[model samples]
Target: MKTSIIIADDHPLILKGLNDFLLEKKYNVLASAVNGKEAFELIETHNPEIAILDIQMPFLTGLDIAKKCKELNWKTKIILITFEKDENIYNEAKNLGVYGYVLKEFALAEIEHCIDSVIKAMPYFSPELLSYLEVEETPKKLELLTPTELDILKLIAQNKTAKEIGELMFISNRTVEKHKSHIIKKLDLAPIQNSLLIWVKENQKHLE
Candidate 1:
């Protein structure tokens, strides 16, 4: 059976290039898409053996598509094709157990090998792509924030106390203290929550 493929990219030229490349290699071009929502529709119809996905597209991003693919338990192999080289994005892709990554610049050069490698259940990362993934462990201290802090800051304008806030947020007094410490460090404010709340409300429009 012929290997069926799909390409998802916003650019018409890029999409055409991928279609032409796959067609020249005698692969069945099942579908092509300009965005994530359209890609999802195509996947439902074609269920291609492989999908070449661009990270940044209109409506929804490729990461959203990847997440949806996982949720649906689809076994289709995905070859993420993008210009982005962010470590966080690459780590997310890896965690999703994607098959391959082909940089747009190198796709033509490495296309055939990448397809074959993925079919054999081996992961393939483009030489250009490998340098972007420098995933480091997030420090426990940095990530460690008490529930009180979260609740207080997230809904700081509610004007609740450590006791009242904890009850509302479903935490305890000790947790509240930890939250206060974390909040102090985070906002560099006085020990009181009201002033901090007012300050945050005044200056945190972007956050809201």
Candidate 2:
């Protein structure tokens, strides 16, 4: 069966272009939504195999929709399309379990590969985004964070509680708290009140 998809973008031309291109590729385009609100409704109603959402949208951001899907345990996979090269945004998407991240300028050439990868339950990050990160200088404290610690921090930044983070990561709440403590110490923010959360907010731009 052809892979079914719902696409959401605020820009009409880009939305139509993507719709036309997917149809040309022989994929099933279930619906097109002009804004995030409509997109969420269409997704819940249709339950398409995949959702391609623009990062910025009216009423709801793509990340917002992704978070909602994660919360509801929706089966639909999400692919976020954005013009941002920010690491924080990318990390947040990763934490939210977004299957694909495609840059707008590279969409025409890379979108097919992205969709195919997501269908196979593999992640597909834009090559351009990866290349940008490769060249960017890593911050000292960020470098000290273990992969697991960084993942937990991203969840915390999204306001997920320890229990929620533990459930998502399949670890215990105590383990999550332990990791949080390590993160705070590693970042050298122990002196500040609510230091981890404060540091996450303050350094979010660099994290991105």
Maximum-TM-score candidate: 2
RMSD of each: 15.3, 9.0
| Candidate 1, superposed: residue stretches over 4 Å from native | 132-208
> Which 10 successive residues of model 1 have the least lDDT summed?
134-143
Q: Given candidate 2, what's the lDDT at residue 15? A: 98
lDDT of 1 at 106: 85
Model 2 whole-model lDDT (C-alpha atoms): 0.85
For model 1, state the Cα shift of residue 113 in Å: 1.2
